[model samples]
Target: MAAGAGALAPVPGVPSASLHEFPYPPQTRPRVSGGSPAGGVPPATDLVLGATAGCLACVLTNPLEVVKTRLQLQGELQPPGTYPRPYRGVLRALGAVCRADGLRGLQKGLAASLLYQGLMNGVRFYCYSHAEDAGWTRYPGGTVAAGAIAGAVGAFVGSPAYLVKTHLQAQTLSSVAVGHQHNHESISGAFESIYRQHGVAGLWRGVTGAVPRVAVGSAAQLATFASAKDWVCEHQWFREGSWAAVLAGGMVSGVAVAVTMTPFDVVSTRLYNQPVDADGTGKLYRGFLDCVLQISSKEGLLGLYKGIGAVYLRLGPHTVLSLFFWDELRKMVQHQQPPGP
Candidate 1:
C-alpha cells in the first residue's frame, strides 16, 4: 500500500507490457468543471471519496496493520537472533496480541488508524487528482512525480495521526511490548499528553521519516497500476475497463509498493514510536539519516526489512479494496451529477 499508502489482494492475472500499446485515457486529460480548473470528480468530492475508501480499507486491514507495527518494533536496534521474538510470525503475532489484549487488542489503534487513513488518502487523492487535471501527469514521468508529491503532502498532513496510531498499536502489555511504550490511555489522551509535553511541534514529530515513506509508496503504486492496466489489456488477459483488469493492476501495484515502501515504513515506524527526550527529540535517532545509519550499523541491512511479510499482507488487500472503493464511489458520484449546460 502507499507507505501504508494503498494496498490490494493478490489477483490471478498476467504481466503488463509496453506503454505504446495502451495510451493514456482521454478522460484523464484536464477539463474545466463547474467553472473551476479541475478534472474528473471535483477536488472536494475526491477528498471525500478517498477518505471514505481509505477508512473502509483501514477498517478491514487494521488488524494486520497492528500486527505489522508490533513486528517492526519487536527488536529495534538489536541483532536478529539476540532479541526475544515473542511474535514469531504473522499468525503467531496476531495470536499473541489476542491472548494478551483480547480481540479488541487486535484493533488497538482503530480510531487513530481511521483518522490517519482518511486524512492521508484524502489529501493524497485530492492532490494527485488536482495535478492530473492540471496536465502535470501528461508528461513522461509526470504520473510518478505527481503521485510522490501528493503522497508527501498527504503524509505531512497526516503525520500527527500516524504518530498517535503507531503509539497506540505498539501499546500492548509490557511483557510482549516492543519499542518504547508511550502508555497512552486513549486517542484524545495521547494527543493531549504529547501536545502538553512537547507543544504543537511535538505533534508533527517524525514527519521527516513519514514524507519519504509515503512518497515512494504512492509513486510506485500509481505508476505500476497504470502500467499493469495496460499490460493486462495488451495481453487480452482482461478487458481494458473490466473488473479483472482493475484487480490485476491492483495486485501488481501492491507488490511494487510493498517492495519499495518497506524500508521507509520501518524507519518511519521507529521514528514515530521511539521514546522522545525532555525536549521532544528522538532519543534513539537525531534525524532520518542518523536513524538509517544506526539501524544499518546496529542491526544490519535486513533490519530495514523487519516486517516485510506483515507489510505485504496488510498492503495487498488494503490497496485493492481502497482503490476499488475509491473508483466505484467516484463513478457513483459522477453519475448522480446533473449534465453540464
Candidate 2:
C-alpha cells in the first residue's frame, strides 16, 4: 500500500498541470526572435526610401521614358509627305533620339517625371506601410486591397505631373518630327501652357484611364510581393536571410505590375498623346470607356495593349530596382537606429 501511494504522487520532474488546477503561475512561452519576423519595412522609412529611389530612377531613365512616349504617340496627323519613323525597341529608340535630337531630347520631361515618380512612389510606400501596420500585411488579400487604395490616391495626386510629363515628351518628338510647336520650354512651361489653353481640365486629360491602371497595378504588385515573400520565408532555402526576401519580393512585384496594368497603360498613353483642337472637340476618347471601345473598334483588341511589351520592358526593371534599393536603404536606416531606454 505504501509503495502504491508513493507511486500515485506527482512524478519528480513532471506536474499534472491543468488550466483549472495548476498550482503555480502559467509558464511564459519563449518568443522566437532574430530579425524582424514580421517581414515589413517601417512606414516612414519606406516612404523616404521609395521616394529617393523613384527620384533617382527618374533621373537615370528619363531619356528612355521620353523616347518611349514619342514612339507610342507617333503616327497620323503629322505634316504631309514626311514619312513618320517607328522605333524598333527601347535601345533602338534611344539611339534614334540621340542621333536626331542629341542627349537633351532624351531628358525632355525630366522635371515632370521626377516630380511624378517621386510623389507617386512616396504615397505608395507610405500607404503600403501604414496599411501593413493596420494588419493588411497578414494576408495576401489585405495587401492587395490596401495597395489598390494607395495606388488610386497616389494616381490622383500625381496626375497633373503625369499629364505634364507626357506632354513634354510628346512635344520633343512633335517639334522635331512633325513641325508642330508649342510654347512650353520646360515642365513648368508645359503646365502653364496647358492651363492657359484649356484651364484646369487640361491637366487631367487622361485621368479616367490612369486611375484603374494605377489601382490594378499597385494591388498586383503588393499582393505578389507579400505572397512571394511568405512563400520564400517558408522554404528552407530562403528561411535564413532577408536578402532573399527582398529579391523575391521585388521580382514578383515587377511581374505583377507589368502584367496587370498593360492595357490601361496603353489607353493612358494614347489619351495623353492625342491631338486636341482649339475648341477641345477633337478628343479621341470621350472617357475611359469610350477610349477602350474606340480602340477595340478601330484597332482591335490588341490595340488596347499596343505598347504593353515596351511597358513591361520599362516597368519591370524600374520596379525591381526601386523595391530592391528601397529595401536595402530601409535596412540601413533601421540598423542606424539607437536602442531605446
| Model 2 steric clash pairs | none
Candidate 2: C-alpha RMSD after superposition: 15.1
TM-score of 2: 0.73
Off by over 4 Å in 1: 7-33, 36-39, 229-245
User: Each model's TM-score, in the order given?
Assistant: 0.89, 0.73
TM-score of 1: 0.89
lDDT of 1 by residue, 1-341 (tens): 43457521111132223332221222254456474333246777878999998999889889888888998898899987899988988999989999999999989989999999999999987887677677776576776788789889999999999999999999988789899999999999999999999999999999999999999887777667666666667889887766667667666666777788888999999999989989998899989999999899999998888888888777657776787788678768867776654
Cα misplacement distance, residue 78 of candidate 1 (Å): 1.0
lDDT, candidate 1, equals 0.79
